[model samples]
Target chain A: MILINGQPENRIPVSDRGLQYGDGLFETLAFRNGELELLEQHIMRLQRGCKRINLSFQHVDSLRAELAMLCAQTAEDSVIKIILTRGSGGRGYKAPLENEAIRIISSHSMPEYPEANQSGVTVRLCEQRLGLNPTLAGLKHLNRLEQVLARSEWDDRTISEGLMLNINENLIEGTMSNLFIVKNQQLLTPALTQAGIAGIMRSKVMEIADSMSIACHEKALTVNDLLDADEVFLTNSIIKLWPVKTLLHNDTNTHWQHGALTQQIQNALKDLAH
Target chain B: MILINGQPENRIPVSDRGLQYGDGLFETLAFRNGELELLEQHIMRLQRGCKRINLSFQHVDSLRAELAMLCAQTAEDSVIKIILTRGSGGRGYKAPLENEAIRIISSHSMPEYPEANQSGVTVRLCEQRLGLNPTLAGLKHLNRLEQVLARSEWDDRTISEGLMLNINENLIEGTMSNLFIVKNQQLLTPALTQAGIAGIMRSKVMEIADSMSIACHEKALTVNDLLDADEVFLTNSIIKLWPVKTLLHNDTNTHWQHGALTQQIQNALKDLAH
Candidate 1:
């Protein structure tokens, strides 16, 4: 089901800047049982994204109300996506002075992944490098061609996710999730000061680690660092946590056993999800 | 007027990847005196963009026919925009296996600019820097939030355009056009190998300069190079060529006269337009 601006509709004007220039922001939340997971965090990220791009989005309260109404009507585990755009405009890159924001909220059935994926999944390194822009980094804005292109690099159903590096060859993130590596019982994730989405689940995991008295740091990582890690994992809203059992790069496979730290983090994340 | 998939409609499904992830490409062409300016060149660029992004777009011939029909029915000067998207998809980054492309073609009235702009216009240096990614550079794809953000840096009516640089501080292009500078009777434009759009008019100007026995080269440029140049100009299809009379940077105004080389190129472009 879809609600465009609180109305039951599935179509938007072609002139919308979201469709024209990808000038918008979006948030995807998991709806499990009768509750929406991390709804506040998702809304906060969306609000920050709007501010970063200077989009005049003033539909927060109404959007939340709509999401709640939609979730109440949905009984199964689902995915909720919210999109806010600068609305329709005439032909030009210059945004209209007085513009109203467009809000699109939709629900979808939860993806059914193999139960084994939670225990371990194989991943690959993508050839498509992300562009480094500090101004737009860490914001889940609508400009996602880099991720789309990276995700298109492979079709092997066995490989679950593709990790992406920036043009400078520094590991940034996975196509649809955040990357984390454990070394010497310490947790480290790539610093998204240049590229990559600051995933909602990524932050929650870090917070969980902190509450558990685990040391977690954000730093610039590389393929070699990932290969040498004691353990590896990926996180996103839908896929709460997937331990990377194997990394396929240049016809070479680097393997890692789902270590104790990864297991502990997964258990903590699972507790938070419920 | 608008035609979506050869039908008269202006709305697209909310599930379109174009709106979701900007998984698309577009071209903007000028229509003048019952003719589409550089229609073939625009189509060629669109095709190249489709190939670069690996989008399966097989509507080139039919798109041309539709453009011809639309142009034939309209009798006034206007602007034409063509957008090709990966169409609608389920909630995810992975593209649909058998994706059908969506084509949207629309026409708008010609923008009314001041006659004085042709002589020369003022420009400003934008604080927003573009990201460096050679894979996605030079193609006029739908992922243009960087450009949109750069354009939003200022709202000064007197400033005709804002120039942007990459994260490394190399001058790339204007918000909506390509940049060229002249020094010692030689023409130089920034190479779009890393960033910036490869504008059609920029190519035409370089070709005309080559035929006219003028020296033109593509190289990495800097703001100092632009400030020291004897002549500087911006180019795009709609605004054929706008010589820069003044550059506003950090409250310091560097001025230039509309030099002979810029005039020659402008005259050549005018001839081609008619």
Candidate 2:
């Protein structure tokens, strides 16, 4: 099902700035058993994104009401996507002085991943490096061509995700998820000050780790550092966590066995879900 | 007027990857007196963009036929825009194994610029810097949030355009046009290896210079070099040439009296248009 500005429609004007210039922001969230998981966090991030891009978002209360109603109507697990565009405009990049925002909310069935993904998945490094822009970093805005291009780099079903590096050759993130590596019983994830989206699940996982008294660090990471880690995993709104078993680069590959830390984090995530 | 896949429609499916991830490319061209100016160059650049990003463009002949018909129907000057998207798909970054491309073509009336713009226009330096990515650079892809953001930086009516620099602080291009500076009777534009779109008009100006026996260079340029130049101008498909009368940067304003070279080039462009 889809809704354009609270009405049932699956089409937007071609002149929409979202379609024309990718001038928009979006959030994907999961709902389970008549409740949205991490809805507040998603809303907070969306509001932050709107503020960063200077897009006025004044209908937050009504938007929440619509989302809650949509969640209540869903009978099973589903993923809900919310898109806010700068609305339709005449030609050129200069926006209209009085442009109204467009809101699109849609729902989709939950994806069924292979059982192996729950245990551990294989991954590879992508050749396309993300462009570094501090102004746009850490926000889940609609300008995501780099991720789309990186995801299209491979079609092998065995490989689950591809890791992306920044222009400076520092590890940034996965195509659709945030990356975390465990070394010497410490958790470290790449700092997204220059590039990459800061996933909501990543923050939740860090909170879980804190409750368990685990040390977590957000710092610059390199491919070699990721390869040398004892354990690795990925996180996103849909797939809360996925242990990574192999890392492939060109003709060479590095293998790893799922460690205690990975199992413990998975257990904590599951327990928190209930 | 608008056409989607040769059919008249102004709306596209919300599921389009172009709206979702900006997985697309676009071109804006001008048509005058029942003829599309630089149509072949636009087609060439569109093809190059699709090839660079691995989007199959098999219907180039048919696309040309449609464009010619659209241009022939125009009674006066007009601006036509062509967009190619990866089509609609299920949720996620992974494109469907077999994706059908979507083509959107639209037309609008030509904009009326002030007579002063022909003599010279004033511009300001934008504080926002472009991100560096070689793979995506030089291609007029749909990931244009940076341009939109830079354009929104100011709302001054007198400033025709804003100049942007890359992360390395080297001058790249204007928000909607390419930049060229003249020094010692020689022309130099920024090298776009690291960032910036390689504008078709920029290439044409260089060709015009070559025919007129003028020196043209594509090299790294700085803001100081731009302010110190004897003359500067901006170019795009529309607004063939606009001389730089004044450049505003911080507290330092550089004023220039329109030079002979600018007039010579403008006359050359007008003659070629005939």
Interface RMSD, in order shown:
0.7, 0.7
Model 1 agreement with the true structure over B76-154: per-residue lDDT tens digits:
9888999999998744898886675688998888788778989999999999998998998899999899988888878
Q: Candidate 1 at B31: error in angstroms?
A: 0.4
- For model 1, residues A35-140, the per-residue Cα lDDT tens digits are 8888889888888888888877777898988998888888899999999999987337788766767889999988888899998999999999999889899998
Local accuracy of candidate 2 as per-residue lDDT tens digits, A176-209: 9999999999999999999999999999989989
lDDT of each: 0.90, 0.88
lDDT for each residue of candidate 2 in B12-49, tens digit (9 for 90 to 100): 99999999999999998888756677888988999999
Docking class of 1: high
Please tell me how candidate 2 rates in CAPRI terms. high
TM-score of each: 0.98, 0.97
TM-score of 1: 0.98
Local error of candidate 1 at B141, Å? Answer: 0.4
